[model samples]
Target: MLYRDGLTREGIVVDVIIVGAGPVGLSLALGLARAGKSVVVLEKDPGLHTTSRAPIIWPRTQEILADLGVMDRFESASIILKQFTMWNADSNHKLISLPISELKDQTHFPQILILPQHKTEALLYEALKAYPSVQVHFAHEVTGLSQDSESVRVRYATNGTSESEMVASYVVGCDGAHSAIRAALGLELDGITYPLMAALADVKLPYNDPNWVFPRLSVKDVPVVAVQIELGEWRLILPFTQDESITMDERVRLSVKNLFHQADYSLIWQSEFKLHQRISPQFALGRVALAGDAAHLNSPVGGQGMNSGIQDGALLCTALVKAIDTRNPALLQPNAEMRHAKINFGVNQFTNILTRVVMLSKGRYMPWVLRILNLVLKIPSLRQKFLMKLTMLGD
Candidate 1:
């Protein structure tokens, strides 16, 4: 039932038209469809995202996924991380340890899960298929968007070949950083991109620790970070200097060699990235609203990028369902304001501080800083507070 050249005369109309089928978009569709609302998810890409991007799902996000009825599937496909250890790579000593397992009394899913973004999307897509009222169209690129006093009319291309149109009562942009819906609405994403660039690669390492996740930083010669994603696969992040002389593979190899003193690992995936700390001025504009990366983008230090977006989807859908039922679009304003506040005060601020600490960890004062940090974390109440902030359960 895919629409090719424009919609039929008696064409299809839905309660909500969601642009982008990423985790945020898909999560929102699942919530809206389950609430008995007709939903249509439009994705420009032909299939699921395969990259190992955004691998950590915090406890708060796990709670939301549980409400979506897909936690069991995630539990089977992912690995739970009970503890996070930050090491002084130069000295080869542990700087601080955050025990995530101790939070069991505060939450049902007490630990963070290391599941790749692609698998998480697959589970959500499968769950979405059970709803007859929900329709997902792939290779459909949104080209134009306009809204009248009542509904929104979206113009798109099917596989970049033909044009089509679909109208809906509301439209949401869950697209990534370069969101078409956000651009079409003439809104600006304001923030600064850090001068530093990060090189990320997934590799099979010789280290075989299972329950603990390592954040090895402050190596002697190289400034980089490494974290274990699964059993044998690890993700490494280093500053990308854009030196045209050295190949990306060489940079990754050198970083790994410098940190681990071993050259026996195999590369799985690699990419260079520039970090940005930005957020849109407003989350809602008339009948069109933005969520996920479209609404905000922050440092990946705390693994809050995907988690915050999932939270956005869950909260926005609840407000949208009520607004649709009550015939009052103003009900969505509260959600927009609340999400904006959380991103600004909670995610952005926290991650910014973390990025700074990691960047400065190799400085002369880092040893003293680590000692003080270790002492603070030894306090049970303070450690629990830190855990709540990292897990997003504090909100």
Candidate 2:
């Protein structure tokens, strides 16, 4: 479909050009294309089937997918999550629970959906494939960008050989952690990186349970949380499993072979992820805007990573559509500022809450502290309120 009929670069063209084909970028591309904007998506990876980054999709993210007209496609591929179990490592005491049912009536998709992030991206890519004006170029990387008063020039290279160009009225950076667009803009990101590198491994559970369950452990060895998924698969995120924790290098393999006793299933993929809490000082730099991980990143606690990023994409797309229609950048400016404020506040609150929960094993008086914590969870009203926030039902 190359327009090689002596057609040369003439006028300022293209409604928008997006960099990155991850979930955030793909979702934004679909949203903009549906709004009648021509979009070009540049992805460095030529194909999919690489990593299983985030496995749990929160309830709120389900709502955003529903609005995009492809909720059923995703729902068919994942399982529903409802219950959680927390157990003491040394003691037999355990807490098992489910999210409040009161939220079922509040939204179209009322339950948590558990699916791999790779699958999520595949579904969105499939939907976007039907759009005539939307083009996804694989192995294409943005090399340089220059902005003038009227338009932005994007230079890209394919497979590090062939070169091409595109002129976009506006550009969106969803390129992920090391975004070229963000770096070119000279944005400063300031935050703290925790020392403990979290280990995530997907394994099939030996036991069978019909319901969704999350196991929280306060064992003498290390703190752990187990999340159940469909098809006998489960995700384990725990501190070092041994009393004398091994180095970060051997944690994943050793934990799977000995600590977790989950060597039956294929190891699949493993990583030592740093829990980062950071956000861009500013989300929008002139006509270039940032969303998803490009804008902020936080701990995967409470399954807030992708949900928050999707919310940012939805809001940014809606704002961009409005701005394009009115031919005014001001309309999109507020979108970046307002969403950045909300995301900053939310990330801080979420990080603080997760830090406290995971650090519950720190206090010297372990047994006595556990008793008090159980007492608070025993209160009907108190438990209900806390569960709402923990399940992301609360504002």
The lDDT values for all models are 0.83, 0.70
lDDT of 1: 0.83
Candidate 2, residues 159-212, lDDT tens digits: the string is 989888888777888888878888888885667665555677666656544433
User: Model 1: per-residue lDDT, tens digit, 142-165?
Assistant: 998998767788999999999989
- Where model 2 places Cα greater than 4 Å from the true spot, the runs are 1-10, 84-96, 205-222, 240-265, 360-388, 391-393
How does each model score on TM-score? 0.91, 0.86
lDDT of 2 at 359: 52
- Predicted structure with the largest lDDT when compared to the true one: 1
Candidate 2 lDDT for residue 10:
51
Off by over 4 Å in 1: 1-12, 87-92, 206-218, 240-247, 258-261, 362-371
